[model samples]
Target: VLRDERCTNLSSLIFATIFFGNLAFRAYYSRKM
Candidate 1:
C-alpha cells in the first residue's frame, strides 16, 4: 500500500513537470516565431 502511494505521487510529479515544460516550450516557440 505504501509503495503504491509513493509511485502515484512520483508519477504525478513527473506529469506536472512535463505539462509545465510543454507549456513553457510552446510560449517560447511562439514568441520566437
Candidate 2:
C-alpha cells in the first residue's frame, strides 16, 4: 500500500512539472511572437 502511494505521488509530481513546463513554454513563445 505504501509503495502504491509512493508511485501515485511520484506520478503526480511528474505530471504537474510537465504541465507547468508546457504552460511556461507556451507563454514564452507567445511573448516572442
Model 1 stretches with alpha carbons more than 4 Å out: none
TM-score of each: 0.87, 0.90
What does candidate 1's lDDT look like per residue over 1-33, in tens digits? 999999999999999999999999999999999
**By how many angstroms RMSD does model 2 differ from the true structure?**
0.5
The lDDT for every candidate, in the order shown, is 1.00, 1.00
Model 2 CA deviation exceeding 4 Å by range:
none
Backbone collision tally, model 2: 0
Poorest lDDT segment (10 consecutive residues) of candidate 1: 4-13
Residues 1-33 of candidate 2: C-alpha lDDT, one tens digit per residue: 999999999999999999999999999999999
lDDT of 1 at 9: 100
lDDT of 2 at 26: 100
